[model samples]
Target: MPDQASPAPVSTAIPPHRGGLPDPRHFDPVIFPGAEAGEVWPPTHFNFHAPWMHEAGLGFERDASGGIAVVRSFAHLRLLVDIETAHQLFDLAPGSRDFRLLRLIPAALRCVERIIPGDPMPGPLLDEEEEVPEEHHLYAATTAMVERLAGQAGEEGQALAEAMRRVPPGPGMFEAAVARCITRFGFPMATVAPLARRLQRLANAHARVLATAAAQPDYAAMEKVVLRTRQPLGADRGWVGGGLLTRAMDGLLPQISRPRRASTAILAAAEEAMRRPLPLEAPTRLILEQDGYRDRLLDISVFWRRLSAAWMTVDPDTTDRREIEALARNTLRRLSLTSLYRAPDEP
Candidate 1:
């Protein structure tokens, strides 16, 4: 987390490949192809997902070639690192390229020695039974802690939800409810403050879109609001990345078969209202029909619990403690809270 006035220059040396395949004989084939095993790989690849590894001078090069060589080398690294360790270090799945790469390391290492003449071969291959990496105990422990916190937060949210339902809908009321959740639940302000603000902003946008569509009853106007209000609901946003919200949406939402179809569906009821003289509440009701608010509330609740668990798992005296804290702080900063709330403007 120490500020470097200038970032270290990235190596432009491409990893050596034959027939567009990574040459396993080369040291650090996935990252620095011509360099030795002890040489440092570029830190850029792990900048976001595995910053601890980057700080430790371990990480592959970010390559886009999609060649067999890079893939093979990556597989080798994954096997070398093992699954439980990889998970603790970075978000990786058993079906991931890293996981699948384990099968290729032995062959790759043998080929590497034949090509390089004196390069050290990889250690003996792991048996199939041995290949199954151990569970990430830390994550398991963290999840237990998170569940306890979530139970407490969920009760607070339930209370707020009850109060919220009783009050008539009005401007700033949703924001007030969100503020109350943060205060009553005792969620970390550094993280929850920004997320609550974003939820409020999205609620405001939803409200505005409904109001505008109801008042004007035009497809073009409604479409503009839809486009303007659309927010990124994916893993690219930090903290939310690899979290429950990302999982729920990725698991539940149908794949994009056509451009803007999902967004259109979100506004479909509003579009219908454009042609029919429906009640003022109709468009907003239709928007809620998609369960957007419900999902968001769930996401908010889960995010805090996960973050709290992560905080609980860290030990201040550990070697990577600073890195862990830095990672958490950086992710919180990148939660994109600042961009969420905006003044309503003509679309």
Candidate 2:
């Protein structure tokens, strides 16, 4: 035998489990090397376990901070724990000098398990299968989203959504008309209620201020109504009609006086009082003051009413659930990110 080749040095390196996650049913405790202790693993760089697998994959990974974090992709629910918390959570043997990859999977699953029902799959990620809605399913989802977002604000938030939900048929023509304003925006069902209530209150308050303006033009009292009207539907300030008011005031003030009197005095007064202007236009004030053109002003002021009408609007034959979900998810995300979107001060 010509120089029998020495047995090739046995390689001990283990390749990544890219074939997809191992079957949890047959999983065994995988003890990590003691030497790897205290060394941080990069994200998705599992020392032992693979990522969690679902239609979307699941698994915990070392987050950017090099600590273990379990995240539910939908709703962005996340739980972070330190080494000791992890040990306590998984009932790891004290002083074992090893980490078990299997322990983290349950942790990750628990994170997903905690998501509120009807919350969509986490987004900016691919859309997940949501329940197909019935005739008014979009409305239901919209209300559900409202409840969740409001609940996040505290008890007041919950009460607000509920109150909006129970709002009886409008007491008056204007209120009823206000309630229907958001209808043409293709906003179906209860989703329109909260927004309608918001718009209604603002419109009523605006009408009062305008009425005052047309008669004695009580800048002081009108200012108070305009200021109060700026309050948002819930704790989410962004949902308020402040932007709508400003634009309306801007248009109304310039054209308010017959000869196009510069509205600087009224505008300055509104800016001083409300921190923004009122949502009143010359025509709306004239209509409210004279009790005419109610329908015309409503048609004009319901935010993109004409644009929605002119477009090839697809009426919800059933329900465009995904669109409602996307709206809810995005709204919640923005509210969460907004510095001002916080729980109301405890009474």
Candidate 3:
């Protein structure tokens, strides 16, 4: 017996809760469908000549000289979508009755509405609107684009300024455009895998409390999911207490951020940190291929994952119950292994 010290994987063993629930929960995990070896998260990439989150709300910061910056703002959106997907998978599985895409789709839509005020280009994406939707939720894109198309003055760069001046999308229209983006993204599945797994961990722990209420026919778990959708583990600290992921991604208000680019020294230090390796054989080496900021961002993001994992496990009180603690540790360890190595299939 090779140190049966580590317990069995929860993925394989169904929880023998033995409580009065009929039928085992059938969850065709929406997190990521396949063996865990070679999944590529395809970081926030999208179909566009220009890069921008179609209809998402996030924080931003600019420099003294003025320039564009992208922020990591999808955490909340990721979790709600993750858990909702989890709920559907566990509740409906495949071949079940019409589980009502309306149910989950609308809930996911609400997340977009609540977060994005107007479908204004998330950040600098405000311009470049070639074809305006016959009707777009965030017409600011149209306004901005029209301005740019109208043209900038010889000296004023009036086009850019004018585009920035356009009013944002109406509140009502915001949801429609974001809905379009979700349809395009096909649910935040790859992005939110970490989130879904965290929710699985949470829903499992909250079962005692939630199950009691779930037993009541009129119980409102959907609302709970709405209000309680926090960012997942290994998320930015700004996510604590309901802060937006963009706030974290934007890297603090302009007043307080470090000189990221200037410190070639820091980038080098961080880059060197990546020279080491992690366990298990993943299949993608994304860092090697990404150009410009993605490389630095990946390094920072990977470090955050490593640092947080180390800290979270130390405080056992914060961990799942003892029975599942080992499983949780094992699961997290497997994920952490990804941070150390470029997966074999990242090309």
TM-score of 1: 0.19
Residues 60-79, candidate 2, lDDT per residue (tens digit)? 55556644565566777667
Better of 2 and 3 by lDDT: 2
What TM-score against the true fold does each predicted structure earn? 0.19, 0.17, 0.18
Cα TM-score of candidate 2? 0.17
Cα-based lDDT at residue 9, candidate 1: 92
Off by over 4 Å in 3: 1-156, 167-323, 338-347
Report model 3's TM-score to 2 decimal places: 0.18
Models ranked on TM-score: 1, 3, 2
Task: Give the CA lDDT, 0 to 100, for residue 109 in model 1.
Answer: 32
**Residue 216 displacement (Å), model 3:** 31
Encode model 1's per-residue lDDT on 243-284: one tens digit a residue: 543343333223211112322343454333323432222235
Q: Please, what are the lDDT tens digits per residue for candidate 3 over residues 172-279?
A: 332342343345434443433332233222222222222211111111232222122222332534324324333331322231112222223333432332233321
Cα lDDT, model 1, residue 313: 25
